[model samples]
Target chain A: MLNVLWPIFIIISIIYAILSGNIENVNKSIFDSVDNAVKFSINLLGMTCLWSGLMEIAVNTNIIRFLNKVLKPIMKKLFPDLEPENKASKDITMNIIANILGLGNAATPLGLKAIEELQKENNHKETLSDNMIMLILLNTASLQIIPTTVLSLRNSLQSDNPTEIIFPVWVATICAALAGITITKILIKKGM
Target chain B: MKIINYVSIVSMPILIFIILMNGVKERKNVFDIFLKGAVEGIEIVFKILPTLVGLFFAIGFLRNSGILDFIINIISPIINIFHVPKEIIPLALIRPISGSASLAIATDIMQQNGVDSFVGKLASVIMGSTETTIYTIAVYSSCVKIKNIRFVLFAALIADIVGMISAIIICNIIFV
Candidate 1:
């Protein structure tokens, strides 16, 4: 369904772009902004390394263990299949930590590692287990707390209060996560 | 400037050592892993370059062609009916196309409306919270080999709506 729909959506978007005379503007924007994009990517890569290093420090200093201790009950509820000592649990913790700090570029590798760990624990190879589905859903709706990248962009744009939206961001993301998890649970119950 | 440069240079080796110690491997594998990571990074850049170019062009054309305004106008009545601020419409519309572009728009709104303003904060929150719609759908569907994701697509769209509404309400309640 998506294979057909994706091509159609892309085609429609292209047509829309052409009809709206956006193609020319888009071409200009692309060329004009490529330099900035490259610069931004470099800066982002540096930031990612900084944060990942901080995460590594946290792990080495046993802060992650403390976090895991606090988060254990919640993790149990969210991922019932995985035991507390499992590598999947640790990877999930790391992924969620990276995500909450708005280090999505860093989180991708952790997420992949988590999934691989989960796959190893799975006994059946036929279909995705319940835990895998839940993990994907949760990951898709991971709640960001700091929104570091957005704040950086705001700061770069010279906004007066770059961090002013932090509370709202937290609230909105928490709500989305709750709603997504609820819907996912219902869907799973209904065998969808 | 001299002090800063000296500090950075002095700290560089320590930083590398710390990162190396985080893994179980010795100094040799650190270099190897860093090289591997660099290669992968370049590969990702090459893969996404075309899509980024195309997306930028499309967004640029839409803005210049006045089509964005037209669409915004058409939706203005509904927007007003919902008491949604005019500034948020573009962010909502563009969120599907590109997250970074939507952030740029959101920053502009924040600049114009005052970052503490309800609409500005809401736009920021929305920008921060949601994923790039088309990108997420494309990546996930391709991964699962699911050809027919009409239901999934609709669910994601509905999720975006919910995300938007929740963002506005939460921001208004908390900030305003």
Candidate 2:
């Protein structure tokens, strides 16, 4: 089903791009943006490190433990297969925390760690477990509160009110996260 | 380059110490694993490079071609029904393209209008919350080895609708 639709979608996008005169600009941008891309990457590395360090500090100070205590009942409801003491559960929680803070780059390592832990528990050769699917859905639709990265970009661009988006961003992300989770569960129930 | 090299050099020993404390018995083989990881990272980057370029080109061409304006015009009536500014249509349209590009557009809106203005706040929310469609599709599909994720795409689009609607509702309540 996807195989047929994927090509069609790509073709349509390509036609749109060509019709819209973006192909030429895109060609120019590839070269023109390289320097900017490099600079952005370097700056992002620094930001990621700072955020990761902060997260590490939080963990060491038992902030994570506190979060776990607060989130335990919710986590249990979301992930019944995961024991409270499971390393994967902890990694998943950390990833969610970083994402909520809009620290996506900081969440990558934690997400990878979570995946590694999940793979270890997957003894079966075929099909993802319900918990694994749920984790992926959650990660993909992780609700953000602060949207730090977006605000930073706005500031860099000299916007007067960089933090103004916080309220709307929080609402949108939370709703999207709920919708993604709900749809995933419904699909699973229908045996998709 | 020099600063990056210096940082890497300083960090190497710390990484090694952390790995050693983790009880990795084959401590000497850690270098090999590190190199392997680097290679794998590079491979993944190259694998996605073409798609990334394609996505960027598509977005760029669309913006330049006035397709965005056409889209805005068509969607304006619907958006007006919700009391959202017509300018926000473009940002919403581009949200699924590239995060940075959408941010650029959103920033432009904030600059033109007051950032605290209803439209600016709404655009910011939409930009911050939504995922770039192509990037999400590329990442998740590649991970699960699912060649066809059409259903997932539909599901994601539906999720994006919810996000957009929520952005409006929340902005009206808090920012307006």
Candidate 3:
């Protein structure tokens, strides 16, 4: 899907840039943002490393297991077909925990691991299942606790109070997550 | 807000302290383990390098080409009904598809409007609350070999819309 969409984005951008007679600005930006983006992602590494390392310790010390113990029932409710003791359920809980902590890049592999496990549960079905859809909804809405990236960006840009948006972000994301899950559940009930 | 503030301030210290205490109890080389995990974390950063490059490249072209303003002008009337600023339409449009683009735009917004301004606050809230919907869908579906996305796209998009609207409301209530 991204394979197709990515090229189209590039093509349309170039064409539009030319048509708008913004060729010079566009040309300048090509060199400008590319290097900056690379540097930006690398700069993200410092924070990600700290979080991921802490999470690694949490996993090693069985804190994550305890979290899974608490979250399993809720997970079972969300994904009725997933067995509480199964690998997929555990991965899902781990993914959710990582996401709630606002571990963006770190959460992707965890989510993909979840999808992989869910695939196994589906007996290798080529099409998406209801649980898969629900999981994706949860991921997209994200319901994060600390929006670290936004805060860091704000701080870098010298916001008087970088973390001021924390409350609003949490409230807004909860609404998004609840609405997303409800919509997915409704769609599932409709057997769509 | 206070709870969030405390959590944001205290969560990291508490987490690290617990990990240290656990490491001591468990009799393991936790520092080495941490370094290893950190290395893996750096690898994850590198893993996203390609996506970042492509996204930034496209965004740079599109944004610099003035296509965004043109599109925003077209959508201004509709969004204005919801009291959304014309400047924010770009952030809302690209946020669900590309985080990097939205980050760039949000920085620009803050740079232009001052971080505490209504539009600046709204952009921050929206970016924080919403996910890269299309990218999430694409990565997950392919990972699980899910050929048909079914209702996933609609659900993600709707969630993004809800997040955007809530960002607007919360920003107005809190920051405006």
Candidate 4:
């Protein structure tokens, strides 16, 4: 996806600069960007390391497992059609837990695994089931307690209080999650 | 609510404290374990460097050459109905398709409209509040070999709109 979009951006900028006669400024910006990006990455380095190390501790302390345990029953309730002990449900639960913590990179593999497990139960072989639809809905809803990446960005840009949006982000994502789940349930009940 | 916000803000420090306490309980080398994970985290940052540089260059040139604003002008009237800043139109468009694209755009928005400004805050909220629905559907449905998405796309897009609307309204009330 980036392969296609990146080049288009490059081409558009070059052409637009030529036509608009802003060629000099565009050229300077293109070169200046690497330095800025590196600086931004360095800013990110501290937080990523902090959080990842903390995640290791959380793992070692069995905190992550405890979280998984708490969310597992909610998963079963959400997808009542699936067996209580199903592997897909386990994967889905782990994925959602990771997402709730705003660990997207962590959630992705679990989400993929869940989908792969869902594919196995797909007797239709080519069509989706209601359970799969619900999983997809929840996974893509952006329900999270922390908006980690955004906070990191704000910190990089030197916000007075980087985490100020914490409550607002939480509210926004909760609304998205609720609306997503409600829409999915309504659609499924309508036999879509 | 303010108390809850403070709690969540300090939640990580508290989490680290609990984990270290548990580390001591388990007789593990807490410092060594932390160092190991931190090293891996640093590696993740370096891994992202090349892509970040490339994206930055592209986004920079686009913004500098005035193309982004030109495109924004084209879409401004339509989006004015929702009263979102013209600067964020590109973000709203690509947000559900690509995370990096939207992040690049959000950074651009922040650069243009100072980080604390309403537009910048709105961009941040929107970026963090919604999923890349089309991209996610493409990946997950393909993984499950589901050709017919049926109402999945519809429901997801509706959620995106709802998420976007709530993000705007809430940010306006609080941040603006």
Best by TM-score: 3
Please state the Cα-based DockQ of model 4 relative to the true two-chain complex.
0.47
Model 3 stretches astray by more than 4 angstroms: A33-37, A44-54, A124-126, A153-164, B1-4, B28-47, B142-147, B174-176
Q: TM-score of candidate 4's chain B against its reference?
A: 0.62
Q: In candidate 4, which residue ranges exceed 4 Å CA deviation?
A: A1-69, B1-74
Place model 1 in a CAPRI quality band. Answer: incorrect
Error of 2 at A78 (Å): 1.7
Can you give the lDDT of residue A121 in candidate 2? 82
Question: Each prediction's TM-score against the native?
Answer: 0.71, 0.70, 0.85, 0.69
lDDT of 2 by residue, B1-176 (tens): 34433442454355335444432443344444444444443443444445455555445544554555677888899879878778788788777656667778888887787666777777778877887754555554455444434345555667788888888888878876
Query: What digit string (tens of lDDT, one per residue) describes model 1 on residues A72-116?
Result: 988888887688888778878877766765567666545655665
For TM-score, candidate 1 versus 4, the one ahead is: 1
Error of 4 at B139 (Å): 1.8
| Candidates 1 and 4, the one with greater DockQ | 4
Give DockQ per model, in order: 0.23, 0.19, 0.60, 0.47
Residues B82-101 of candidate 3 have per-residue lDDT tens digits of 78888888888888877767
| Model 4 chain B lowest lDDT segment of ten | B1-10
2 or 3, greater by lDDT? 3
Q: Write the per-residue lDDT of candidate 4 for residues B100-171, one digit (tens) a residue.
A: 668888998998888888888888899888988876776676555566777887888888888888989999
lDDT of 3 at B79: 82
User: lDDT (CA) for every model shown?
Assistant: 0.63, 0.63, 0.79, 0.77
| Candidate 2 Cα errors over 4 Å, as ranges | A1-26, A29-70, A116-129, A153-164, B1-54, B64-69, B148-152
